[model samples]
Target: MSGGVDSSVAALLLKRAGYDVVGVFMRNWTEPDAAGRCSAEEDFADVRRVAEAIGIPYYAVNLEAAYREKVFAYFLEEYRRGRTPNPDVMCNREIKFGDFIEEALKLGADFVAMGHYARVRREGGRVLLLRGVDAAKDQSYFLHQLSQAQLSRALFPIGALTKAEVRRIAREAGLATADKKDSTGICFIGERDFRQFLKTFLPAQPGEIVNVDDGRVLGRHEGLMYYTHGQRHGLGIGGGFGPGPWFVAEKDLVHNRLYVAAGRDHPALFATALLAEDVRWIAGAPPDRVFRATAKFRYRQPDRPVEVEVLDERRAFVRFEAPERAITPGQSVVFYDGEICLGGGVIDRVRRPYFEARRSAFGDVFDRVLL
Candidate 1:
């Protein structure tokens, strides 16, 4: 719940529905701030206030060691390997539904309820995961990795309400978190500077920022670990070929070099195909080996038409209808058949154009593209 209005309202709704409602705030991160205080403590205080206002029994479960081992350790490892893994997806799969659900059942819980902006329903004796009614706040992407058993025991109370309506409900109920700002991004790091925070764990090794289009070393980068695909800010690059801003096209982990491009529309940033590994289908089984669907490589990306060919048990190739820009490895590519999420996987690598695989600036792979 993290002491937010959404979760507070979730508890209220559950209690109203005649269900035994208990609020549990899991303490997964214990990283101390510069002031020698754990931010989770402040969040726990807010949880307590919210729980009291909602008139429910609340408890704070310590999951720091488990989170460090399962989620945080893998997050650092991915960065070290030059991949930007989405910790939020892994956190939902490992922590929220894994250890936390186990704890809930031990307390004789029939099911676990969350404030996630997603929906679940039972259709033909199978529980289905669906997008939230709020299009702008739909979180089915992060919830894509959830398994059938997990979805069966999960409940989302705020799935139908808009963000504004959620706040209004909290205010009407006189909940303390009524006006609380929604927490964005990863929860562990909060609002800390990413590079400075990462330095505590991974010592940055400065490398030459090389231009990808032309073999030109423009400037020195702080570290490859601090950068990701299509990043333009905080790169410390200046005075290139023209009065220009350079974007991070790629990170050469082998050479420890950061590749930069002249502009956002650089050809090197686009990819027509990608290989996805570590796939998880929410339906407890993969869909057809070869199927056409819409996919989103990043959370903010619109669903683009794609043709997926499942290769093995947990691998597949996705050919996007249009060339995707900066299809970074280690990010999840969620596929959907219309509004129903078809599930997806981690991007292992992306395939761009060479001489034999050239594409036009408008994303046409050949001289003529089919309508």
Candidate 2:
């Protein structure tokens, strides 16, 4: 259980169905806050209260060592390489469904359960991962890296319930987390300053912020890791303001410099195609030839039509029908056929034919910029 209303209600629903429900709170990451406090302790207490109230056997397991080695190490490596990686996907794979399931089975669990807002379908001995009934709250995007084996042993008890309905059920059950605010950002450091938290691990290296169009130096940034592609806010830039404030257009990680564009619709922010590596298809390998499908480059983005070609079992080349903005590397690009999620892989590179030439001659040539 996450000490949240979702997990608590999941356990309750299973209990009502006459199944042997056991609440397991897996303490995965224990990164200390700036105040030296670990928030996992607070969550543990909440889980205990809900598990007791529901009259089910509750237990806690410390998976800190495993999480640090498996999930956290990968998270830091991605940032070091100037790529944004989603640690939640790694946590779900290596820790939750991986280690947690092994732990749960040792405790005699028939099936592992989570509060994820996604569903699983079994037909003709083929298991399919489907979007939850609550489209607004559908989390199949995050779980897109899951394998067939993981989905086979997994259960999402609250996939059919809307967020409002889940909250109402919690209130009716008098759960402690009925009104608990939804957690956002990384679980280890909740609501803390993102850049400041990242600096704790990734050393801050000062870099120049260059305007992408004119190649003019705007200002200095604390570190490239603190900024992301196409981000408009948090940049302390001044002057040269034409269309609006500057946005992060790219990161010259090799030179330790950041690139900015003046307008939101700047061409520097869009890409025609992207390359992804480590593709894992839940159903199995997709057809080797080029195929049309829908994909989401980021979690909040809507699925858009794309042409996908399976370069290999672990990689693919994707061309979006429409130009995609802020296609950052190291983020997962999940594929889908209608409501059925077909796994995904981490983005490796974005192909920009127009920018590729300009990016090479950026620093020296100023007047040649288009906009």
Candidate 3:
């Protein structure tokens, strides 16, 4: 329980079902926030209270070292390479299901449960990952990388319920975290400014912010790492050029340049194809060498029709039926067949129409083609 209503309700539901539930809070980040306040300690306190109220034993297991080596290192490395990485995805795979499961098994636990808004089903001697009943809060995208073994030992008690129902259950049970606000953004970063928080690890390397359309130098950027594809608000590119606001269209790591587009719907902000590497299929292999399915480029994004071709074991090429906005690199592109989450992979490259048109002029600098 992360001192939240969702997990408290999950534990409550499991206990009510006559399952022996033990609350194990994995302490991943030990460092205090900018205000010198330790959020983990506060969260654990809530966890302890809820465990007591639910009549179950609870323990806090420190996984800081494992998280830093496995998840945090990869997060910084991706940003250093000018790609925005989703650390939460790695956190779920490496820390939550990976290390946390091992720890739970050591305690003679048969299955490890989490508060994630996702589900699993056993069919034909195979474990299948499924999206939660709450379409708006479905987190199967984050858990897509999990393997069959992990899914087999995983239980999501509240996957069939909506967020409102979760809060209602917690309140009715008199749980301490019934009204607690759900945590958002990167877990370690908390409510702090993302750009400022990233700066603590990656020092700002001031670079030029150039408009992709006209090549006009708009403003100075602190660093390409501070921006992401399709971001608009923080560009600081004041009005004068056009009626539309400036949006980050791409990052040129070779030149240390941040590329911007004038409008939100600019072609530079959309992509029809992408190449993903380090692919992990939950079923241990792709359904076929080529198949059609629905995919999500990021969490909370509505599913889109796509055609996927498995080039090899660790890579796949994806073609979207319609243009996808801000198909950012380093983000997981989760694939699904109906309710079944097939798997996902890290977005390695994208094919944008605006960039393709200028590829001849820019030479290899704009070449992100995978075909």
TM-score, each model?
Answer: 0.93, 0.95, 0.97
What lDDT tens digits, residue by residue, belong to model 2 across residues 205-262?
Answer: 9989887787777789989888888888888886555666788887877678898887
The lDDT per prediction is 0.83, 0.85, 0.90
In candidate 2, stretches whose alpha carbon ends up further than 4 angstroms from where it belongs are 357-360, 363-371
lDDT of 3 by residue, 9-128 (tens): 999999999999999998988688878888899999999999999999999899999999999999999998888898998998998999999999999999998899999999998999
70-159, model 1: which lDDT tens digit per residue?
A: 999999998887889899899999999999999999888889999888899889988788888888888899999999898889999999
- Candidate order by decreasing lDDT: 3, 2, 1
Show pairs that collide, candidate 1: none
| Backbone collisions counted per model | 0, 0, 0
Per TM-score, the best of the predicted structures is 3
Top of the candidates by lDDT: 3
